[model samples]
Target chain A: MQTGSLEHISDNNGPIIEVQDLVKKFGSFVANDHLNFTVSRGEIFGFLGANGAGKTTAMRILCGLSSPTSGNATIAGFNVYTQTEKIKRNIGYMSQKFSLYDDLTVWENFRFYGGIYGLKTEKIRERTEELLGRLGLQGEKNKILKEIPLGWKQKLAFSVAVIHQPKIVFLDEPTGGVDPITRRQFWEMIHETAKEGITVFVTTHYMDEAEYCDRVSIMVDGKIVALDTPLKLKETYRAASMEDVFLKLARAK
Target chain B: MLLPGSGSATLEGYDVVKDFRKIRDILGYMPGKFSLYQDLTVEENLRFFAGIFKTTPEANYDLVKEIYSQIEPFKTRRAGKLSGGMKQKLALSCALIHKPEVLILDEPTTGVDAVSRKEFWDMLDRLKRKGITILVSTPYMDEAMRCDRVALIQAGKIMDINTPEGIIKNFSSRLWSVRTNDTYELLLDLRRFKATRSAFLFGQHIHLTLVDNAGSEPEIRKFLEDCGHQSVEIEETRPTIEDCFMDLMKG
Candidate 1:
């Protein structure tokens, strides 16, 4: 019922991502249909769905990895179609599995990501040292990626993703099988990044994890059926918890 | 699929599929990926899924509206552009939005913030009151307490299934949580002790599994001190669900 359009919506600032009447089709399958939503700057948005729900397809469009069959979308004020290169430059991404080289050391991973972002060598070195020290990786800088524990690897992956300090960062499930303690530590890093005015977009299946997001969307069968804060969703569903609400919604479908 | 060789294999007290679905329905399930949309924004994502079960965001708009303010800030963000917590909320929103007869979550809190982790389980408590069958799988032993019933699962097998308290109650052995000046040295010394069966480190505390015939705590502490372990502290503690799980797996 809160159908406030993105342009007029005021909260974290202007809309960083605006999708209007978005549609995506693959042969006979409608991957996405009549999608519309807005993401404000510096907000941590949550994307959720069951498998084969077209979540990845929508992400590809926003990241400029694929074109939409219909509708309009803009990221960081640039069109996802016409200004894809610009969008790419302003946003960083980390896949669910991670986006780092196992063969490279922590410092090398930082340097590589910094280099790709076009940071100067001196700047890269300075930033790399700062990151390594902040993450308590100064001694582990030269350690092979494979040798580090999973929690440490997750931390390192986050460090590399933000090496260039992009305006927005997209993460797909960033935490899957890691221990609970490590996952908590990783989220601390995410909070730090968001504090710096960097928008975060992430997709995951953990309902409890959604309570931490600024807002969340539930996707089923290639469409988004609900979008709200965890508390709001709970209250609306008349369910005591997000999980129950999820089950209720999932079964209703 | 891997059943214990020692058990009498029978289903429904009869056929596997005949009773599996019926029994499974008494439990809820939330897979690592509940299978949602990736490309759609938070709003569309909810709507699409809502439509699938013959429901609309409009039908449940009031309930959705209650959580709306929390997600309003990021409502327009694409599903792909959200964070772990955000995605978790979305996925849960999809799962609970329809209200199932049973709720099942597979490692739902595996990767999330401490605050979010707490918040998520709190939601589950509310749902439990509604009398929905809840079956959840998690690797975290601490979360065991939150469930009405827990089934410690490993490698697709159920190690133990019982109420949280019941599981802990069944932890047959007495546990000692000890810390020493030379923890590693103490561990080595403890391992060789005739009364000790297992000695391993869990964070800062060294947990020792004692033999059935082990001596009293005071005597054990004295023995440890005599072995050159300084400032030894020992507590007779109840076994955790994890301990039971390990015991089950060992069997």
Candidate 2:
């Protein structure tokens, strides 16, 4: 329970993400066990845990992509279970795996994803053009996604994930295998997105990236063992960096 | 021990190209990126690896037993079908199938999850306890701390090699962490500052170096204030491996 809030809780308008005693199970095996926390609007909340620490399970439940065995959660003011479709419309999803269709051209991928989000034809075209220009992919707009470099493709996947301008976004290890340089740039993009008033919930194994978060929750097994701002966690653990803070918590019990 | 497109290298006091078989006999290598045959089961892969070292699996069963036991439950399952962690254990078992004294792992935990990544390192520690020389490389700087010593590399060039503590201690710069309402703009402002030596993005703060100016802190504070940054705070900070790596890369 060594902790500080992601932000000083002064607004009291309710968290954009609220999970209360959340639980998920595969028969007798518990994936997420009575997890409780809230993510503020436009905040970069880093969800961290070991591979099987229930980070993914909780995120899946939050994204309305899956159901929990019990407990309650709400995202963007919508219930995760009863208001999934409504929740889905408020948040974008991106993962390490490029979500763009490899066989489709860059424009096609953007157009298709933009269409799914109910963007008007004119809006989709405008966003696609803007996205292409922003990514410096104007020359590669017609090229199939498979033809682009992995770095560029990852950026496109992220852009398309947020193409419809959701109120919040969930990034599951978005730059998992990217090099240091590209990873930094990707985070800058995240900052830009947050600047635009979109909350970002990111789960990552890279500790350096975890430092970029406003606050981080490090889960162990099926429970959240440590939660705080990266600097605070480091101080609490008497560690120099987030990686050590993570290692300290991960090895604590 | 091997570098691409180079002349024959020496390993364990033997020429890699000239003493191929001799070198192979005493070296244990787990490639950075690897795949086990989808059609081969656990035992089958071990048998194949044993053959590569010109030995029977039974001869070195004891050496691989510890790691193999973890994956033994899925012995009949295809190697390709194992979970990432299990697959890594299996790969390690295969590499150790011949009881080579020297173990070389290239990013063995690259894609493994956090828990399994720790487990893998624990296993390496056990191997080290048994007098094995373990050589490992990982992109994660944090993992570098677990080692007895480390070398910093950037763009195929070696920056420095020292114990993790040594590298941090040797970072010769006045590093500071600057936090403000807008970190992105803070970085841009610092980067544009004349006295700024190097500026790196570190979580919520910018890790910066000053160009030996007496009023550097106040000057930086003034610059951020001019940029209209709110709640700005700047303080000297200890450098992490990532910070040092960024600094080293600039050189």
Candidate 3:
């Protein structure tokens, strides 16, 4: 009966992400409604929600890409309103597209993103070699992005995003269309990065990924309805899986 | 639709190479990608497909009424501008427009959202109840449990063909639920264990496949505890469809 993580984490300490009643409105439509949550340092936080459930809006606010209509949020100790540039420098992002230049070779793409992040030439080369070796792509330096397998490209995208050694990395549904093998490989990379003390804030449709998170928050119609570890959330909802819990919460409203 | 092989294949009791024409009549094939006329409106695309089948949309109105009602509001909108879920509904509606006895959907939920994917499967269940023989192919192992019977195919070879539960029944290897606070370290530690065959995160727990039978639990559990993980709990767990598929793939 001694379940370590089966209990909800209400202690709320070491907050890397702090949101206070965050609200976003486009015209009269509220995309985010008084959202509140916290992500601890070095935690893989899973942001779960149905389509158009304001997950993107809240993420935009955290990334300092968009201004909230009301309330507030802080990322890496920088205020979302005023310290956006500082916040941007400290955070990494990998979208669904992976955002790599298909025409460029692996090294060329890495060099381009490295220069954009203001990394020195020597630092870029060092990180490039280290990353390629770590990903088992050391021999693929000269290959074009499009020619490489999708799983490899995704890994490269993730490496490029964190090339500047950001404090936090935001991944928005990175493993959506991949098979189970690739997904496991991708999650291994996530675990490796999280081990290095970089915070991973990810949003995913797959319930299996939700289980990988240190903690998760489910958004429903622009609000944080459930925020707990996967085990605790499943226990609270009396559901077998996160998908079932999502359906139960998503349908209850 | 055509898989090349050394020998001939069969389709619905007919030889695929010999009865291609006859097989096409009963098959309502929907390509994974939405392959409708992008410039055409929703109604226009449906009408076009209906025409190809030598029937008017009005003649098959009852057949597609259930699905069409969901996407009818966007009847005038171009197919290219529709959302992912709407596109899926439209594609399904068009596929039903032919009134074929068999429906073959090739991973219809590939790039769709979770809610839409669930809805798509629900639609399939309804169609199945109408006495349609549905053959759905998905790359998602988690969906294997949803079907009455599944064929595990890899590289043009059939691994196993049986009910979902039957496939799991054949997973002779013991699987474990290894839970710890630090997954990264836990993975690294588990990988170093002698008896550990495979360790991967599933949901919140690391699903470990032991190399031998029931002999490695205590040793692996002790190893985890020795790594300074206080709440490490390793328990014998049942294999899921994905676990069975993974075990099958290893051979």
A227 in model 3: Cα distance from truth in Å? 1.6
- Clashing residue pairs, candidate 2? A211-B203
Residues B93-114, model 3: lDDT tens digits:
8888878888988888775656
Ranking by TM-score: 3, 2, 1
In model 3, state the lDDT of residue B193.
79
Off by over 4 Å in 1: A1-13, B1-163, B166-251
Q: What TM-score fits each model?
A: 0.54, 0.80, 0.88
Candidate 1 vs candidate 3: the TM-score winner is 3
Q: RMSD in Å for candidate 3, one decimal?
A: 3.5
DockQ of each: 0.05, 0.29, 0.35
Strongest candidate by DockQ: 3
- Candidate 2 docks with a DockQ of 0.29
Candidate 3 stretches greater than 4 Å from native = A1-14, A79-85, B1-25, B37-39, B77-81, B111-115, B155-157
Clashing pairs in 3: A211-B203
Candidate 1, position B193, lDDT: 83
